[model samples]
Target: MRTVTRARLLIVCLLSLRYGGHDEPAAQSHGLFCASADAHPTPFILRFRKTDRAVILPAYLDHIFDAAAAIERKNARRYLYTNNNDSWEETPFNHPSTFDTLALDPGMGERIKADLDAFSKGESFYHRNGRAWKRGYLLYGPPGTGKSSLIAAIANYMQFDIYDLELTKVSNNADLKSLLMQTTRKSVIVIEDIDCSVKLSNRDGADEASEKATDSNTSCKLTLSGLLNFTDGLWSCCGEERIFIFTTNFKERIDLALLRPGRMDMHILLSYCTFHAFKKLARNYLGIQEHPMYLELDEAMRKTSIQLTPAAIAEILISNQDSPDVAIREVLAAFPKDMPNERAGNVDGGKCQLSHNESKQQTFRQTMFVFFQKTKHLR
Candidate 1:
């Protein structure tokens, strides 16, 4: 009879709960026999839990509450929030970014998706491991490497809210803690530009307990220890199924403690563009499988060692959408012959790199066009 209460708590629980009552076990054993087939909707259940009536069931009356809705919560609306006085100021987040649209390596993209799946389904795994049911991601790369886009993609994929935690706006550790505590479960808590967010003292620099109570400097700096606690400490456990994403333009500038395994479980580095990435972007933007200029561009990149960001390459493709030939040729000539040889950096020193790089490409478009125009005469 108590079966009336907890269907979800049991079915999705991965068998964590202890079984109840003698007859309950029998009922579960013969659960299929107890099953009565009735139409039910994923978005809703047209039923009632309790029954109360007299006068011979009181001539039972019920209304057919039939309707249709999206089970993935599309109508529920995703939100983006910013910290405000220990509360979140919400707005509709309509970013169209998704894994499908992302210019990520197929393998890296799949791995990230799989990791998210495992984490979302890891309630029992987390509980059994005696750890908080949360995952921390550190996205460090030069700007314009799709760090923000990846964040959007992740939010869209998980159907989670994005809380853009601006540490500079927070007054103190208490303020930071309050903001974090106010966040709900299944949220992506993002702190972008972590290196530049606050001037975090070294691990051995200041006493965190004292720093927590201290004052405002250029809009109050959150200490390293405080940031650490925010990620891996007791306060972070307040919400379940939370994802903490910390982005830095320069990973080398970050403190060692913050880069630790437990605090930043996944350190993703979105790096410079590669031929493979260019091909994917080409497919997305130009709708071309193979371009005559691809081999020339690829070979030029290998020879001159000029690296570009996806954003930069994308700009070329977009700016010259009418002509794929120009786009590829311009991309080829964009790299300067005298530019220093750079290694286009590895995705990360961790298992998942931006799931996943090197550095920024914000000015690459302007640079590319100017370079192309100047070099066109030589071509």
Candidate 2:
């Protein structure tokens, strides 16, 4: 009877298993597994299937996951280069201010500080609402007047990199556009000698010299329209916060269209070094004070036809750096015997050329801390 009862219980359990019915143990607690399927499909997994279907995410999705995945892959792979170049190992640039090195024109410092502050803070009044971000400067004056130095100062002050774009290097308008696009924002893009770079529409053309009143399309290979587009076009607006400085010895040489109301925001005239500038240089380089020659020298400089540039004066100051007397003497020696009016054309034609005297170079290197300073004051 006991064996028959045991056989009946075993048959009952087997029949329950076959019908997919199970009884929980008396000690087992009731709870949920709490597992879920993926809420969204993978982009790659969806792409693998040949269907005109797409996976979309909510508008608020920041796409942080995709960015993280990209970063992870970048870390795993090494960038390969064909050439073994040590160029990347070059030391980082230690930006220095104009005050640390150069002797600048008086009132120049104040102007630069003001402009730089405006530029860095993104409040340069020229930038309009929803317009292209750029500033145009017409630095026109004789050579050795500090145009280049000013550029360096602006760059250093703003911690902005410089793109010294030579218009001649660009093959065409397209090439010019590519170079412009490659330039990073928060940079000063300089086009030195704009007057010489290309011919202007209003100017007398190449044929003008031979023929009487010739009109052979004064627009050189690079036209004024093209340059304007380069500065303030739809594509130009692509980059944000940039300054475009165009330096020229002859502002008149540039086309009128180039200097029109909206184009050149500021037309700064880097004139001859005045007595105030000279005094500043004296303090900077010679540390000279109330010398007996000061009055006489000032008078002489005022009367001289030689009309020394800030660069030329700086050269003299540097040469006589060790001996203030010597530097002043050199300046006096360069002074013209006859007092002449300030002449404009090619004023620095012969002045910038280095003499055979090694002393001049040595003095320049020793005395003037900021020899490469720019002439056009920004403020």
TM-score versus the correct structure, for each prediction: 0.73, 0.58
Candidate 2 Cα deviation (angstroms), residue 238: 0.9
Taking the tens digit of each residue's C-alpha lDDT, what string does model 2 give over 1-379? 1222221111111111111242333212221111112333322111111121122222112344555554564343221111111111122334453644444555566776776676556644546555566677777766677787777777666656677776554434565676767767777778888866644332232443322212342322444455777887777777877888889876766767777644577766665566667777788888875566777777776665455577778876876689888777666665555755344233443222222353244345433433432221242
RMSD of 1: 9.4
Clashing pairs in 2: 101-369, 101-370, 102-370, 146-374, 146-375, 149-372, 149-373, 149-374, 150-374
Cα distance off (Å), candidate 2, residue 315? 2.0
Q: What's the alpha carbon RMSD for model 2? A: 19.8
The model with the greatest TM-score is: 1
Give candidate 2's error at residue 343 in angstroms.
8.0
Give the distance in Å from residue 282's predicted Cα in candidate 1 to where it truly belongs: 0.8
The true-versus-predicted C-alpha distance at residue 81 of model 1, in Å, is 0.3
Task: Please give the lDDT score at residue 235 for candidate 2.
Answer: 70
Q: Which stretches of candidate 1 lie over 4 Å from their true place?
A: 1-72, 202-221, 336-379
